[model samples]
Target: MTLLAPQPFRPKSAQLLSGLMFCWVLLSSAACQEDGASVNCTANPEQCGIDVEAVPARLYVDPPFGLGFGCVLMGCDEAKILTLENRGGGQLAITSVRFKEGSSEDFSFALYNDEEDPADEALEHPTIEKPLKIKDSRTKALSVTYKPTDGIADEAVLIIDAHDASLPYQDSVLTTVEVPLRSRVLGSVAFVPSTDTINFGYVAPDETGQAILTLENTSENDAVLTLAALNLTDENDAFAFTFPENPHANPGDVIEVALSFTPSEYQDYEGQLTVATNDTAQPLIAVDLRGTAFSEPGIRITPSVGQGIDFGAVRFGETDVWELQLYNAGGAPLTVTPSISALGDTDPNVFHMGSTSGEALAEIAPLESTVLSVYATPAGGGAQEGVLQLETTDPNNPLITVTLAVFGNAPMAEYSIEDIDFGNVVMGWQSDVVEVTIGNTGTGDLTIFSYDFEIGSSPQIMLGSAPDLPVKISPDDDPISFAFFLNGQSLGPANATFLLQTDAIDYSTARLDLTGQVVSCIDGCPVANGTPSCEAGYCAIGSCAEGYHDTNVAFADGCECQEERNGDDIGGNCSDKRDLGNLGDDCSDHAHSVTVTGNLHDAEDTDLYYVKMEDAGSVICDTFGDSFRAKVELISAPPGLALCVNIRASGSGCGGYTDYYDPSYCGQNSYSSNGSWSSDDDKEVVAWVVWKPDATPICTNYQIKFRADD
Candidate 1:
């Protein structure tokens, strides 16, 4: 059987359709051709229309790959149209059409008039009043609108029934056709979070980390997204997710969901979070949440808080050093800060102690240790106590303290002055009183049993004032004070002794010797190269002559350091550079100057000098002095021949020349290695004692030493 579609058919299909209709007519004429006489149905259908029950109308549908609304959002409308053609000779009446494919209300059908009925714009269900009518060789549009109500793949069978209305009830000539309808509906809007996956990074045990999941509606402004459900599945029970309270969201609206993760063990944990929303494209949003719980920092001290560092017996004025070990036993880095506690007044007998560990340590890697030194210096006797406190970033042991204990047991009397000299006194002249003090440098009390004085040749010196006959001195008590006087009555040198009898275990007596020259005060001090003055019945070198210093500060030693000025290199300018005579071939064959000790009063005190190298390939010099200052060796060229350039303008701590000096003060031409520049024009290299810019005093007290390297 050949079916001719009323749609836009191909030319070949139309030609084939005309041939089939002609063949059907010929077959009908041949059936009535008895006795060689043909009955034409066009003229008079005598036999063709004689008692015949023929099918007048038939239903035909071009599914065109089945009516389908691929995928659409819920509460949204998507429609498709199908052409129903009447291939029969009579008009086709589609009485009704229904959807039987998934029994889902999402898929529905309606009938609309063809181009012949332009006024039938409104969709109408196929029925007796608005039946889908397709005349012979005509077509009508059967519209199927899929308004998905659920988020699932669905299918529906469009059951269309058509028949000729003129036929009797028994011979209704009914036709039924099924067209497959398919569609998929999803949530009306979607949820976009701040992140698709939440990673808590490295979280330590017993620590909780949190992250936020943001929900945003990406649908039209009028469209709303309703959160249907939310859930989380965690096998380890280490994660907790909090769903947003408000379930409804519109376009441009944002929702936030909180999630927290806390791990009890040092292991990896993972969980899955599912959020159900009204997003047709993706109704369920699954996010992977992961985190790792690592071990925390732990501090272990060698001497625990209870057990302290004890120094058994330490004498006053003596120091004892101890060692402390700090260990980190956890998987993370630990930070430590150490401090010494101040001595408490409750204990009169206390020691002064401090830790070399200044303030804080940046970090200590896992399973590491560092050593700290603490020293205890006793200032009093008896049981001396101190504390060393350490603060660390360890959860288990944040603050750790170690105690220091020492005992002072012996007491020895110590005198402030071993001897007193009232030099050169006049007759009948009374000298100034010299105050003397006596202290105990031991653990116990020192008692002054008695006191005595021994005058040798002349009775010139005597006791001006003395402490009580018997006095007790404790290690912590203030030292007792007394006075001595020098009386000049004779003309000659005199000597005397003042002694204290104490109950000291080692020595029972403390003595102070006194001496003086009993001469005429009018004679004054015989100071060399300096003036003399008499004051307090004694002779003194009051002032020095010009260009001289009282270096020894004595009437006899006279004035020394007879330099013009304090500058080391007196001729310290470019015009008057100090020449450090030529050197020998050997490093120390005959050293012109082995070591020169000098102090740089200030940065401007620059000593510019040059040494002539003799029978030597190169000369290397080093500086040894105070570390605060930097010593610069400037290998200079005479005037501009061997230009001595202050590369870093002196005082610039460390630099190229200092690291390795080169004779090439001017830029090297061949760039042969570095700093070694020798001029055939001159042999003198000036070495300047300049300041290291920052630490000018670093090499202030420097011992400039030089030697021939080759």
Candidate 2:
């Protein structure tokens, strides 16, 4: 519910009916209120009609805004009527009706068919000749409209020329009436918003998120705003909108629109909400909307793979336990449970998960890890084999299995880091080193008797920093170490595995897998011109050898789009200006001598060129395609040579083009006198711009051809 503003007391309807029972008011011996076709002749000869909101200039020191049209939004218009009632014994002649001199054209006066009815059929602006005759006790009405051309407070006098037969005429507007009109223009639409864009970061599938778009009517009291439609645009079926129940609104009435986004897919979603209304200034408004949904979590178990884990050197009829780490590597939370798998045809309850470690895990956040333990109690074996199973919520890796083995009084060997990733490596640059610590967590001594290396299609993975072979690691003692890095020898994916052999009898071999990519220059740069290259894994323009410069610091389009030129191109700044030595020297030397053509390249690129007219008496320089986009100006002519330039060019940031005629109001198309200049000081050199004067430069080819008369 909208609350109404308090209005000042105006017992205009019946001021006498208040406080007192009643006043025996009498007007010409008639009842308190009555207005017949024939009014009393005892009153003033002429009075303002009831429909007109005006005060006589003689009565009010500073009269209120005529017709009280108040503030009206730009691009919108409001109209009122001025009525004159004749209460005299004779006819009233209205000679003319118009606004005062110097009054804004925004205000206009026209004749009307009826004062109270504005229906198309009843409203007419037909011209009326001077001295429109009004019989006694009759009323005449004139319509006035206020449609501001600019936003500002304005005041003007509305003059009504008249002559009453009952009064003798005098000099100087003998019978004249002036009504002062005052109004402050408004610049915005009736509907105002709380926010222009709505973004719902991320939501899971089947879940919904909501945002509110508040729209308020901030126009005048009578400027009623009506909502025609409210909903999301096409292709946005996932988002829904609930609008205010009542679609009509007056001043101060607010509408809080609720918009909800429920994405069903696992990718980014985009949409827009359109508010269609009856506001003449802005008929439709659009708000940007964005969100994402449905992300999965990836699970990785450290120190594990097929035959990758070992509970080594356990004595017969004895138990030993090993710890395993579970890591969530993707975007969402993960849930997992650890258990042991039975091999074929064997009562394989010998190797099992620890009691505390078998409990199901839940909600593991991304990049975070949890721990689990497994026990190996060998009965009788040279080496007992078993497999560990991990069930997880990762859609890609639901069931992860790692082969395990137990031996009697044997050495156990393991590598500290199992997986290595060198994110990105330049084609010929070496990657960062990753160290792998080898250690033994068994009862007996661990001996690395030998080692071997294997590689994928691309052998860019270099293994180094290894300790001497035949290294021995006593029980619970420090282990051997090694290092590896991506050598970036070629452009392709690099993969390799290094294996180490130990004295442990079961699962005794240990291996470390390495992976990375050898990328080429410009591999990650987005679309654009120029020879792009990557040095330290970063994209950039390689060289200016092609006569193309990356003047624009954006890597998306590489180098070419920013600045490209052939041999005919000139420099961008005044320092690099092209000097066209001598542009003829005579008045009427109409030969087009210097012809220069160049591209604007971009909005910020300004091409400056100079010419020598030292001996010329007069000159005329003009650029073709006279538009605000590629505006041309003669900065200054040679001191002794009088030059004429096109004065139509302007450097304005108000908008993109010069609407010299103001077709629809693009912006402030203001121009200074610099576009047109003349000088005869006989200076050495003067230059003109292909132009850099302002930001509205057109990004296309511009040409100039002119003659200097001698």
Predicted structure with the largest TM-score when compared to the true one: 1
Q: Give the per-residue lDDT digits (tens) of candidate 2, residues 265-369.
A: 776566888888767688888987766673677777767555567777775467898878886655578888777755653237667776434567667775456
Residue 134 lDDT (model 2): 61
Cα error of candidate 2 at position 332, Å: 81
Decoy 2 TM-score against native: 0.25
lDDT of 1 by residue, 3-88 (tens): 32322212223343434222124311222343455554323333333222233555667664577675454456877778877655
Query: How far is each candidate from the true structure, as Cα RMSD in Å?
Result: 35.4, 43.8
Q: Assess the local accuracy of residue 685 in candidate 2 as a C-alpha lDDT between 0 and 100.
A: 31
What TM-score, to 2 decimals, does candidate 1 have?
0.29
- In candidate 1, residue 523 scores what lDDT? 57
